[model samples]
Target: METLPKEQLLNSLEHLVDGHLQQAIRHFQNMTAHDLLQPAYNGGWSIAQCLDHLNSYGHYYLPKIQQGIAKNIHLPPKDTFKSSWLGAYFIKMMDPETGKKKYKAFKGHIPAPDLDAYAVVAEFIQQQENLLIYLKEARSTDLNAIRIPISIARFITLKLGDVFQFVIAHNERHIRQAMRNVTDINKRILH
Candidate 1:
């Protein structure tokens, strides 16, 4: 497959950040102040905590990506997605036409973030601002030069730009999940 254009990736990064903010803002807008603090489901994070996790992680990734860029370092293999034991069988099961599915259902919710919606949104937006600054200030060569890792059946490496493109697809994947969660949660409570 062809590598994604740099301009496209940067533009998309901007969109994902903005989209995250908008979705969270809109969700909260419809909710009462108290409902925002209620756990999302029986035990899952409330909507506010979800944003807090995203808020924490937005800046959290910077250290890794920055280290990779500055030292020409590649992160440990843990960052990658691994193919399963079914291997080629599952490969055949997937449609080669559509890109990989964005998110898989998982068993558990994480520890809730220790923040309110106001703090979380403020922090999340600032982290995005920092990301934009970093992206703009870094030379194209830096983005093109850094080696980042991913996996299929095994480890593979790509430039920083490619990694972010992959991450953009990943972002859309989770956004879909978040949207679904919001819808499902609202349905359960309101209906």
Candidate 2:
């Protein structure tokens, strides 16, 4: 189990969330429907589809984290957090930079091709704002003691800190993909 100061972990996660929120506002704000739905150069998911996929995961995770926090609010905050082996594995796999392997998303998490670009982007931005609030609330709770069930397998659970890391890493991974799609659309227009 990897151990780190609790504040350090929360701060890093907040930084990632802030970056995502900023990127969404900057890159996705004024995009036309055609640009958002435009597929990547490699024929992968479009920018809107990418956010939609993330929104699906957010719908499952954010509430789980919130509930875990509320349930454990009585416990005194711990100074440090230890990542469970399983949680570490999941976070590593979800990280965009270190995890290069691709796996198919679960069917329920897949985004439809006909999504309204504005609504998807708007939802993603709202989710990010909600995540920031959760992160702040988490500071008063015991990060290591609270457990949250994974969305794919509710029977399994991870430390709250680990869940935060995994969820944010997953968001970062797809947000990067969305940005790549934006680049592809720009290049197509230039040529």
- Give the best candidate by TM-score: 2
Runs off by more than 4 Å, candidate 2: none
Q: Model 2 over residues 69-142: C-alpha lDDT tens digits?
A: 88889999998999989999999999988899997999799998888999999999999999999999999999
The TM-score of candidate 2 is 0.98
Predictions in order: lDDT:
0.52, 0.92
Cα lDDT tens digits, model 1, 76-158, are: 32222222233323333332235454333222323254545566556655655666665554433446556555333225555
Give model 2 RMSD, 1 decimal: 0.8
* Clashing residue pairs found in predicted model 1: none
How many clashes would you count in candidate 2?
Answer: 0
